[model samples]
Target: MNLATHAALLGWIPVVLLLFASLPPRRALVAALVGGWLFLPVAGYDVTGYHDKHMVLSAGMLAGAVAFAPGRLAAFRPRLVDLPMTIWCAWPFVSSLANGLGAYEGGAAVLFNTARWGVPWLLGRTLLADRGGVRALAVGVLTGALVYVPLCLWEIRMSPQLHAALYGFHQHAFDQTVRWGGTFRPMVFMHHGLMVALWMAVGSILAVALWTRRTLRDVGGIGMPWIAVALVGTTVLTKSTGAVVLLAVGASVLLLADGARVRALLIVLALAAPAYMAVRLTGEAPRTAVLDAAARVASPVRLASLRFRLANEEQLAAKALERPITGWGRYGRWIAYDDQGRAATPDGFWVIALGQFGLVGLAAITAATVLPVVRLAVRLRRRRAAAPGAGPAVALGVVLALFAVDSLFNAMTNPVYFVAGGALAGVDVRSLVRRRRPAAAQGRAPAPVVVAGAALASPAGSAR
Candidate 1:
């Protein structure tokens, strides 16, 4: 890490405070989270322990929220849907202790996981469960993508030099920057080009959703149609085949499916990761067939990359199976080593979670991320097709499910998706239930449901 990287990381704390002071708590959280993820250095200082810039920024956001939005924090109530995340955050401690790594290490793991994963979920549940919160988040990410268009175009032509130019270091392997035929893949400040591409893809999904619902006219004064085109064009240019596929799948669903069909598709997508894990573990995965299919569509280089990842996954999964319950604990214990002292790298997040904490940890993390989407789907099913905020809610939920699917191949961790998940998990299901009841039976107008003595704002398009 360079001096500039140090300054950028340390400066983010005050920036968070400034954001909270200048913007509403919800927008502040979005700005701090989304903007920090975009521009902050990928490295951070070790004041007491090794903290990624992500966890450090998350801590700053949590502190800002507590200091400025105490009422919102105090108003948060834990639901059963939140239990999986609680477990996911704390599971590493149990695995640490099980591996005889002692309570000290175990406790540290808990803190890291909580900061990295739990804080954003809490933020979502507390500040972003409302109609206004939904709009802020969706539009915030859409706007962020628009902001990245120029940066991505810059990296595509000049070869991803911004992180190096600004932060004083390259974030990842230089070789990975160049894609097919020496085309540059923009890493921006993220860990990998694929991550940046996926971020753009997610923004595209939200743009399509907001436009389809007629909920958003403009994001930062750029019309939604133009915003959608920019995001979609950038996503394609990123040269990440997986990200393009994700954008395509998301756009197709938002454009073609009804609410019920959307919910059903989300449920299926939610189950995809766990299903792949089961098949991979049982050796029932049709690997050759899949590769053969890919070979026809994927470039030769891409096919070779997929083949290599599958080969490595086989070894890593087998090692993880050896431990079964609480797999080999951290510090590369779960990773297999060859006679030459080379470590087998686990590419997919699913296998890494399995190896690190075994099936218990895998299930916990998967449920934490996946169940919220499933819960939202079920709740939305009970709602009328025209329920306020239903369009963006469903669109955001689809992005969350796609994140789970993406985790099957890449270990890119974005807290924005968790924020979306928490927002979905925090949806006011009771309001939907009450709205379903007949107005005549209630002996009055079907008034909007009030929580804490305040009527929740209806989302856009309701003419409220």
Candidate 2:
């Protein structure tokens, strides 16, 4: 059965709307609307998929109504921190219009993708930035990983030719093949082995944060160490060298940022030892063997895989140089040349962004995206040091670290990444704006609230 077809998409419309309605008055409903819109593509209803654009519009209208509802609308206001990044990130779309490439319909693609993925994440952050929401997101991520990891293990066991058919053998061709305890390598719902590896790496970083902060205690009776072991093990099974490196780097950053000097060192050594053993077993060498070896031990198979990635990076770099200013345009590198031109790398996020958006676009996009994450990391560190037991700080730090690593090789601007990133960004923006409230309140007197029939009447006496 095409499960997508059997699910009733329209049913979710009201359900999502209700969820927005139920939120606290001070909460941002635009986030909910944006997030609800993001799920439209994946929402199929009994052989008839709901119109995605329509869903987005409806959600937006509902959210806007809620936001404009007198006192309810206070949460929807954009903050100073949000403005800079939003404008910076939007520059690419703006530039796309300025360039002749705008005619190619890059705007539609960007908008569609952004709505499908970015909106939900922004809403998730807005909704879940509170201690309760942050915990929910953390649990949701771990639960999703738990469910996804086993499915990946099953896929690996099946050794399905699906990946080869979809992404092609070149993109997923690994240097080594190992059937661990009769279990094959898992690909799960992702496109390739590398993607799976990336997911696992993300899982590991999150698990570490959750474990260290004792967030697992919230789950009742679940041991933190066991969760960490499972996450780390899954990362190893994916056999993605880049992902492994990213996990290590991300975890290290998280630990050091959190000031767990001894624990961080111990965790690093523990995670590194097995990787070293794997490398020793494989015997094949990686392109950046020294760096890879220092981070984690690699087997011959792992080494070969790492070498392939480095080679792809080199090729992508050269191609980017050819069109240093404005990339050949979105997906332009994917256009094959008749033995006359070089092609884009098969699996490289930086290369894709650079090749598609050019150096100017890349710099602008990177700054827009990375700046908040860096700030969050710094803020979390300060917050935790000053006030202990701030688990949300650790969780945010984990998210930033994971993104930092994942973005290196994967186009995290994709749907999932955007959604998550948007949510985190929303939270950051909300917190910043709320902080200025005290000083602002001292200057201007507060307005009185008037409620009517589950909705607040605006100051102008209009039902918001």
Best by lDDT: 1
Q: Encode model 2's per-residue lDDT on 11-94: one tens digit a residue.
A: 444554554466442232433333333222322222211244333434453454444443423455565445534543354465
> Which residue segments of model 1 deviate by more than 4 Å?
48-50, 338-341, 382-388, 429-464
Off by over 4 Å in 2: 1-74, 83-89, 92-99, 102-106, 116-118, 159-183, 218-221, 252-308, 321-323, 333-342, 381-389, 412-416, 423-464
Question: TM-score for each prediction?
Answer: 0.90, 0.64
Clashes of each: 0, 18
> Residue-wise lDDT of candidate 1 within 156-196, one digit each (tens)?
98899999998888989989889777679999888899999
lDDT of each: 0.80, 0.48
Give the CA lDDT, 0 to 100, for residue 446 in model 2: 30
Deviation (Å) of 40 in candidate 2? 10
**lDDT (C-alpha) at residue 228 in model 1:** 89
lDDT of 2: 0.48
Residue 334 in candidate 1, Cα distance off native in Å: 0.6
